[model samples]
Each structure stands twice: as structure tokens, then as C-alpha cells.
Target: MKEKLGVVPFWQGYDRKEVLKIARIAEDLGYESIWIPEAWGYEQFQLLTEIAKETTRIKLATGIANVFSRSAGLLAMSTATLDEISEGRVILGLGTSGKNVVENFHGTPYRKPLTRLRETIGICKTLWRGERLTPEQSTLAELRHFKLAMTPVRADIPIYVASLQPKAVRELGRIADGWVPTFWPYEHFNEGLEWIAEGARDAGRDPSEIELAPFLGVVPIEDVDFARSALKPMISFYIGGMGTYYHDMFCRFGFTENADLVRDLYVAGNKQESIAAVSDDLVDAIAICGSPEHCRERLGEWRANGMGHGLVGLSPGATADSVEFILKAVAPA
Candidate 1:
């Protein structure tokens, strides 16, 4: 059985051409999709357009474009354009990417985030339905209710929401087509699923309608030693630097000591210590990075537990050869 496993490129600090090579290789290996993530310097839609030029079968996603930065209408518009370019294989992955990113980076206040999330999804769906986006829906008095000027490739493009908190998880379950959770520990997997089920039941929607697709930091490397520490630096940075969310969540995942130490070490500029402090238990809670056989085994765990895996490049070693080997090793079929 093909598992429909997807992959995320090492978005930053890698050669652009190389990322495209990863996408092409994933396509060739029959992976399900390539998730593109936007950061300080990169535009996700532009990258997806380039990836579209390179391959035809694999699906594309924003991996997550935060809900705070862009208006829902604009997100809908840009996503629609990408879907058209990709010939109707685009998933708009939305997230409330912490307060620091929203206020410090985007200069947008991260206020009423879940409310904003609900409104955003409603507006996006409304505009895609060729209906006017009322100011009541958008809360922008200046911008009148407007329908998309151009016809979208698919009026109902699949939407996935990256959520970590209970409220956000339940919210996405209530509305989103898929749940793209990050740092979702494997232990409480059924706990998370139940939250979604509760939400679906409350909303009178079928729980199975919402896809349980968790993000995994999978990076297959040849060197036994390096492979062991593959995702440490990136994972440490996220736990410490991104915001308090990850740290708190890790604590909730029963890794309080490790999470605290990693955060303190990373924040205090003890980079090596912080990375070293990322315990194997914490890492294994969310990532699968090792040899091909090892990755296949760990990925099997995720799939058997009833969730699709989105392999985010936890290790920056997703070079041409490694991408090919790992994709083939973890091929859905």
C-alpha cells in the first residue's frame, strides 16, 4: 500500500536549485506531496510555482503561511493562483505562528488568533464560492465585500491548519480539511485525535472528514553519528527561539526537564549545549531521522497510528542523493 507520505524541503540556508531537486526527486519516487514553508526571505507561492514548473503529479502546500500576516482574501487569491498554476493540487496550510513572529516579524498584533482563524477560513471559502466577502466577515470596513475577480481552478481547495494548542486543534478539526500539526508527540496521539473527534461531534460533522496529517522532522543521513543528531539544532532553535508555545507543549508532552534545559541553553547562546540537550526521547516524539531502514520503520509507526506524515527537512542534509534514497526507501507503495 502506498502511504501517501509527503516531504518538506530544507527551506532556508540551502541552495534554491537543490530544493527544487528534492521536489523533483520526491515526485519521481511517487511521494504524495511537497510542503513549501515561507520564512523571512522566501515566498511560498513563488516557490510552489517553481516546483510546479518542475513536476506534475505531487501536490503542493504552504506548509503554513501564518494567518496574521496576510488577509484571508489575499491568502485565498494567492492560493487560488497557485492551484491554477499547479493544475489544482494546492493545500493552503494556515497557522497562528506564535506571538513573536506575528508582532516582531510581521508587525501585526496576534490578537484573537482563533477568532481570526475561524474568520479567515470562512472568508476564504466564501470568496472561492464566488460570493462577496462582507466587511462583517473580514472586519475591514474599508475593503468592501468582494468576490474573486478570476475563476479559481477549484472552488474548494483543501485547507490544512497547523495547530498545537487544544483550542486550535479542536478548531481545525471543526473546520479545516486537514490537520497539519507540528511537534505533535507520538505518545498522546490518540488524545489529539479525540480532541478532533469531540470538535467534529460538537459541530455535527464527521470526524473522519478531517484528515489527521501530522508533521514529522524526517532527515535520513548516511553517517551513523551525524544521523543521530540530525534534527537537534533545528529542533532546539524552534523550542527555544520560535516562542514559548513549543517549550510549553513539550512540557505537556512529559519532557519538561529537557524542554526547559534546551530552551535555557539555546536562549542563553549556549548553542552546542542546547542542541545537545535535545533528548532522544523529545526528538523521537516528533522526528524520524536516521538510515533508510530506520526512517521506514519510524514512518510506519506514524502511518499505522492513523495519520499521514509530512516529512519536514529536520536535517539540512537533504541533498540530491539523500533525497533520492530516502524518498525511494519511504515510498508509499
Candidate 2:
């Protein structure tokens, strides 16, 4: 809840103007960074470019720019350009979006996620270091001889991977500069970190070198019931319709019964029931909601659990004023 917290004002419900307003306010309020997300709405780079021109200080990140959307070399060039334009304030956050988005939306085959991620990172890093792409390292033949025409502001842009599965999380620590975990409850936060550390140690890297930046959903309201209810729909969507990968992860995260129930009800078209089944404890486990005081205490607990930097999502029904209040309440002392 310190200045280590970043703001991820996802552009799902908000318009462009409103998104800019939030970003500007977050920067002014001493937030560490502004993480833009790319699901299906707006392209992350264009929005990031606009934010770069509008703000001078806050660092910019993708929250997660889907790996399936573009080739590794192209991602490298785009990130390099963004870093240059943002004056070296860019963190490349990459994720293998769910099959629904990958196969359906992007029309790309969803196979070899681990290989794709590994190869992408290798290719991007090689290109960023001003080296030509090698055929063996990249799946894209077009990038075989391509070199970035423009010099990048920083050769080493921090790469953060958004992962929840154990194998993916392990690989993240072994190679990525940071991690962006979702639905990561504080109770098992240490357990997740241990997986990452094991991978880091196996790779001969210090575990501390790996940054822990979780994406948390926060709903600030005095009425705990309303706050919990407001968060249920989003939670249901991710756990129910998102995919089996996440459902399995939630099970592993110690929510096996709840996850199974939610999935059953949700898939059976009992949407409201699924939402209703999201227990208060489950909601509280992954998110911070309640009065300002309660939220502060929860964030303190999160900070104590070794939250370094984070990206927080202000839940849907919350006003801009509510977000501002929480911002001040949790700002670094």
C-alpha cells in the first residue's frame, strides 16, 4: 500500500478520456507506475503512447500484452520504440492469454505456451541487445535477419510475466525480472514465492532479484456486503468462464470446493448462483474491500507479506473519488 503500488485502470468499463484522467491522477498522487491492459478493447501500445506523452514521471507497463497477438521480434521492436518514447520508463509485461482470446479472438493456435514464452523472451532480449534474430531462436522467419533500426533507450527493459500455474510461475522466476500474479491470496503468497525462488536458485540467480508485483482487485466501501457482492461477478467470470487452467490454479490455491461449485453453477447457466457462491472469505482472500480503515489494515498485511510493487484494480462500482481516497489512504508514508 506504499508508493510501491501501481495502478492498473483496465480499459474495459472506462472510456479513453476517463482512463487518461485516472492515469494522470495516479501519477500525481505518487503511484509508482501505470499498467495498461490489453484484452480486446484498446491496443495497449497506443494507449501507453498517449499516457507517455501526457505524464512525465510514472513508469508504464502493459499489465500484460498478449504473447499470441504478435511475434517476439515485433514485440521487441514495439517495446523498444515505446521505451524510447517514454524516455526509458517501460516494463514489458507479457502473458499467454487464455485459449478463448488466443484461438477465438486472435485466430492463432493455442499450443506450446511454455515454448512460446521461452522463445519470445530469448528473441526479444537478443534483439534489444542490438543483435540480429537467429532462426533457431525464433518461430518467425521474417525476423531471421531483422535488426531493430532504432536504438533503444534501455537495452534491458524489465520483463514481468503474468502467470498462476506452478510451472509457469517457476519459469517466470528463472527468467523474468518480475511476476504479475492474479487472484493470489495473501495466505498462500509465501508458498507461491517459494516456487519462484526454487526456480531462481536452480538458475543460479538470487531470489531477491525477482520482483513480486501482484495484480489485486480492491473495492473500498463501508458496507462489506455491497463490496463483496460487487466483486463476485468479476471473480465468477475468471474462475468460471476464463478456462480450466485458472480453475485448476484456484483449486491448487486452496479453493478446490469453491472453485468446483462456482464452475458447475456458472457453466450450467446459473450465473447469479455462481456469483452468490463466491464466499465472503474467498472474496476477501483475493481482494481488499470494506471501509477505508479495513482496507488500510489489509494492505498493511499485504505489505508485511513482502509485496514489493503491485498493480491494483479499483472495482467497477467504485467512484473516482473512492479511488482517490484509497490512493491517499494507502500512499507510502
Candidate 3:
């Protein structure tokens, strides 16, 4: 399939005015969707609402909002509200965030990610259908016997699940309208797709109906050295220090064999060494960092691997003009 291309805005340093300008420009650029993220600094829903009002046709999505942070019912209400504001162009992306963010930042327990995700999705679907919710003893218990006072403008809002593990990916296929993921290498896409298909069959849902959208880190530059250098910080941060021993994505990717060495280098502030520890093959496999033509080949591989949407995360110092250039160069003609 010829897939849609999208952009993810780094809403951190921008004021409201700047964000609106970016959103408007993205819409004008013929982009299919714009993903807004929530973290400690910014509110995802508020930013999305503003962007929805500013743009005419582009879709708006929460790149991901943590399932543990809010009550499932409240999340459904927020999703419905955003959908109404965007006139049914909202995609609710939900995830079980890592322990560092969920526990330390949000002051919520990070436990039973699979079960929590299942319950949260179930409750959100129920609430979206205008069903009265009575909280059970699952991860979702903050809102009990609550129903939205106002009626939703639409009940067909798409719910995308942000997942990294096989289990969650499969569960997402079973229940979610779409999948959002990170750190997925093009070569391993089928490893995930197979699990997702299993879940879809288990739930009696068509696997093809589930949209697969994965974020790709791209630095479109002819200067290979510069592009490689720019990706170092992110590589070191995620591969070295993003999570605890029990739940690190990097370790699962085989970087754990050098765990102490990697962490020590990262924590002692030798970021370059930490980046060096990340294998060149792994980095090249996962990220699309090269000239425009090279990026097109990489994107083609991802598309062949079952991805339906490319969510590009442009690196720092990468201008919107550069992004637009790359998009036009690689987008299907």
C-alpha cells in the first residue's frame, strides 16, 4: 500500500503561537497527520486542541498519553472532547510508559503493563460508547461509576496503542484501531506483525484493519558525520539510561551484554563513548540517517515490512524546510 506520511512536533521550547504556526504549516504541506506528545513539561491534549483549531484538514494525535496517569474514563472524555474539537480527526494514542516517567515523574505505580493496558483500553472504549463505568480492581480504578455528563460528538474516534514489546503489540492488534511504536528496525517488522496478527485472529478482528505507525528518526543531511553526531545523544540516552534493569528496551535489543560499561560511560558523562558502544549496524538498521535518496530506500524497506504510516521525528537543527524537502523526495509519487 502507498502509505501516508506524518510529522511529530517537538512542542517543548515553542510557545503557543509558534506551535500554531508549525501546525498550520504542516497542514499546508499535505501531511496526513501531526503527532503531539505529553511529558513532564507540556500537556498533550491542550496542545492538540489548539492545533486542531488552527489546522483545517490535517489529523491530530497524541503521539502517546500514558495510561497510568489519568483515569480511563477521564481519558475517554478527553479523547471525545478533542475529537469534537477536531471534528472527528483525533487519534487517541495510549501507552504504558516506562517506570522512570510513570513512577518518578507522574507519581503513579508502574505495574502489570499488559493488564493495565488491556483494562484501560476496555474502559476507554466503554466510556466512549457512552456506557456508565464502574471501576474494577484493575490498574484503572480512579474513576468509578462515572459517565460523561455531556454526550460525545462521535464514538468512532481511532485509538492507537503505543507499544514496544511483543505482548503489547499483539494486544493492540486485538483491541486497538492502530499501533504506534519506537525503536523498531525495518528488518524486524515482521517479528512484530506476526504477533499482531495472532492477536487479531484471537479477537476475530481483521489484521489489515489495524494501522501500523512507527516513528523514524531522520536527519536529512549529505554530511554523514554531522548526521551521525547529531543522533549520538538520543542513542546514548535511550540505550544507556532510559529505564531500570528490568524494563530497558536497549538491553532487550542486546546492548545489555555491555550494560555496566554502557551505563558507567553514560552516567560518568562520557556521552560519546556511550554512543560508540551502540553498534553502527544497530543504529543504521533502526534510524534513517543519510542523504535523501538513501532515506527513500530505507523507507521502502519499512513499507515492505508492513508499516502503513511513517511518523518522522526530525532531529535538532533540522529545519522544517529540510523536512519538507526530504518528505517530497521520498513520498510516493
Error of 3 at 40 (Å): 0.7
TM-score attained by model 1? 0.93
Clashes of each: 2, 0, 0
lDDT of each: 0.81, 0.84, 0.76
Candidate 1 least-lDDT 10 residues: 309-318
Model 1 bad stretches (over 4 Å): 139-143, 221-225
Candidate 1 scores a C-alpha RMSD against the true structure in Å of 2.0
Tell me how candidate 2 scores on lDDT: 0.84
Candidate 3 local lDDT, 1-333, one digit each (tens): 455878776644535565566567667767788888777877989888988878879889888888889877678888999888888898888988888888888898888878888888888777777887764635445656776787787766788898887788889889999888777766777877888899999999999999889887776668866776666667677656766532265566655665556677888898888777665655676677788788777788888888898897755444555556655655553
User: After superposition, which runs of candidate 3 have C-alpha atoms over 4 Å from their true positions?
Assistant: 11-15, 134-145, 244-264, 316-332
Per-residue lDDT for 169-235 in model 2, tens only?
9998788999888888877889878989999999999989888899887766789999789889989
Instruction: Provide TM-scores for the models.
Output: 0.93, 0.94, 0.89
> Which scores higher on lDDT, 1 or 2?
2
Clashing pairs in 1: 2-332, 3-332
| RMSD versus native structure for model 3 | 2.7
Candidate 2, which ten residues in sequence have the lowest lDDT sum?
314-323
